[model samples]
Target chain A: MIPNIFRLTLPILFGYVPLGTAFGVLFATQLDYAWWLAPLMGVVIYAGAGQILAVSLLAAHAGLLEVFVAMLVLNARHVFYGLSLLRQFRGAGLKKLYLIFGLTDETYSLLTTRPRGGSPQEEHRTDVAITFANQIYWVLGCAIGALLGRSVEFDSTGIEFALVALFIVLAIEQFKALGSQKPLWMGAAAAGLALALLPPAQQLIGAIVMVTAALLLQYNLQRNTTLTREANHD
Target chain B: MTEPMYLAAFIAVTALATFLTRVTPFVFLSRHSEHPLLQHLGQFLPAAVMTLLVIIFLHRSAHWSAPTFGLDAIGPALVVVVLHLWKRHALLSIAAGTVCYMLVQQF
Candidate 1:
C-alpha cells in the first residue's frame, strides 16, 4: 500500500521537491529566520505560492492582518477544490479533516483523476498516504534548500517553472478526461477578462466568480433548450 | 534574527487563513452534495478551474515588457502541451518543459 501510494504521487513528488527547495532558498536568503523555519512553514502552511508570498510579505514587514488577508485571498481557489471533492470525500471519516487541509492544487488534480480503491476503508488510506508522501517530499526539499542556501551559492532561477508545467499537464489531463472544449474555452475567457479588468490581487477570485456564473448560466441554457424541445414534441 | 513570538504568530495566522480557504466549501457545501447544481459543478469545475490556473501561471511567467515578449514562456508551454499529449507522462513533460524554459531564457 505504501509503495503504491508513492507511485501514485510520484509526479507530485517531482514537482514539490524542487519547488519547495526554491521556496526554502528564497526564504533563507531573503528573510531573517533560521533555515529550519523553512521546513516548518512547509509542514504548517503547506502552500507553495502562499509560503513564497508570506516570505516576501514578511521581508517587506507587512502587518499580521495584511498577511492573513493576503494569504486567504491568494489561496481562495482552494474553495473550488473542496466543492469538486465533495462526493469523493463523503465518508472519508476523521481523515477528511486532514484531506481538506492538504487539498493543494496538485493533490486535488491527482485525486480527481485516479481510480478509487477497492473499498471505502482502503480509499481513505490511499488518500492519506498520498497526501502525506507529497508533504514529506515538500518538507525534505525545504530542508535541503534552506541548508544549502545558508552555506552555498546556488542559482535557482527558472526552476519554479516546474510548477507551471505541473499545472499545464494537469489541465491537459482534465481536458482529456472531460472530452469537452466548453470548460476550456469558458475558463480561458474568464481568465482573460479578469486579467484585463482586475488587479493582480483580485484576478484569481474574479475569474473564479466569473467561471462559476458562466457554468450556472450554461446549465440553465441547457435546461431551457431541453424543455423547449419537449414542448415542441408535445 | 526575527523574534520567535512574531514568527510563530505569522505562521499561525497565515496557516489558519489558508486552511480556512480550503475548508470553507466543504463546510458549507457538503450537505448539498446531491443537488443538481452542485453535481453539475462537480462534473465541470475541475476542468474549468484547472484551465484558469494554467492561464494565471502563464501570465505570471510571461515577460510583458521584455524584448522577447513572452516567447520564453509560450515556447516552453507549447513544449509541455505537446509532450504531454504525445507521451502522457506528467513528470517527463514537466521536466522537459522546465528544461526548455531554462535553456530558452539563457539566450
Candidate 2:
C-alpha cells in the first residue's frame, strides 16, 4: 500500500511542482506579492482556476463580491465531489478534516481508483494518503516556484499551458474509459451555447448551468437505456 | 494598484471566502452516507467539471478574434492533446505545450 501510494502520487508530484513553481514565480514577479503568499494560496485555494481568476480579478479591479461569485461558480463542482465521497470517507478521524480540505481534482481522480477493502477504515486510510500526497506535491511545487522565481532569470512565459494540457489529457482519458459520446457532445454543445449567452464575467456561471443540464440529460438517457436492457433481459 | 491596506484586506476576505467554499462541504457532508441523488450527480460531476475547465481555457483569450481562429493557442493545444493521447503522460504534454506556446508567441 505504501509503495502503491507513492507510485500513484509520483506523477502528480512531478507535474504540480513545476506548475506551482511557475505560479509562485508569476505572483512574485508580476503581482509583487510575498513569496510565502503563493504557497499559502496554493494550499488553501488549491484551485488553479480560482487562483488564475483571482489574479485576473485583481488585475481588472473587480470587486470583492464579484471575485467571490466567480470562484463559487468555478468551483461549484467540488460540492458534488464532497457528496460522492461522504460514504467512502465516513470515519477518517483527524484525517477527516484533511480528506475534506484536500479533495482537489487530481486527488479525487487518484482516490477513486485506489484499491482498498470495502471497510470504512480502509477507505479512510486511502483518502488520507491521497490527500497527504496531493498537498505535499502542491507545496513542493510552490516552494520550487518561489525559489526559482527569486534566483532564475529564465523566461517562464507559456508555462501555464502545462495545467491546461494536463486537464485535457485527464478528460480524454475519462472519455475513452467511459466510451460515451453523449457526454462529450453534450459538453461541447453546452459550452458553445454558454459562450454565446454569457458575457465574459458570467461565462463561468453559464458553463456550470450548461454542464449541469448536460449531466441531467445524460442521466435520463442512461436510465432509459438501462430500462430497455432490463426489459430485453426479462 | 491600491494601498497596502486594501491589498491586505483583499487577501483576507478572499482567503475567507475561498476557505469556506472548500471546507464547508467536507465538514458537513463527510459524516453522512451518500444520498442517492448525490451519487447520481457525483458520477457526472467530473465530466461536467472538466467541460467547464476546458471552456475556460479555450475562451481564456476572450474570443476567437484572431485571424486564424486562435491558431496560436489551438495549434499548440492540438499538439498537447495529441502528445498526451499518445503518451498518456502529463509532463510530456506540458512540456510540449510550453515549447509550442513559446515558439508560437514569437511568430
- Winning candidate number (TM-score): 1
In model 2 chain A, the worst 10-residue window by lDDT is A109-118
Candidate 2 lDDT over residue span A117-208, tens digit each: 66788778867876887787787777677767767666655655655665566667667766765555566677777778877666655665
- Residue A167 in candidate 1, Cα distance off native in Å: 2.1
Q: Over the stretch A1-234, how does candidate 1's per-residue lDDT look in tens digits?
A: 777787777767767887888888899899877889999999999998899898889898788999998898899888888888898888988999999989988898778767775787788778888888988989998888788885645544676687788888878888887888899888899999999999987888899889999999999999899999999999
Considering the true interface contacts (CA pairs under 8 Å between chains A and B), give the fraction that model 1 also has.
0.76
Residues B40-87, model 2: lDDT tens digits: 666555655665566676567323675766777777778878887788
**Model 1: how far is A194 from its true place, Å?**
2.3
- DockQ of all predictions against the true structure, Cα-based: 0.69, 0.39
TM-score of every prediction relative to native: 0.90, 0.71
Q: In candidate 1, which residue pairs get closer than 3 Å at backbone N, Cα or C atoms, i.e. clash?
A: none
Predicted model with the maximum DockQ: 1
Candidate that scores best on lDDT:
1
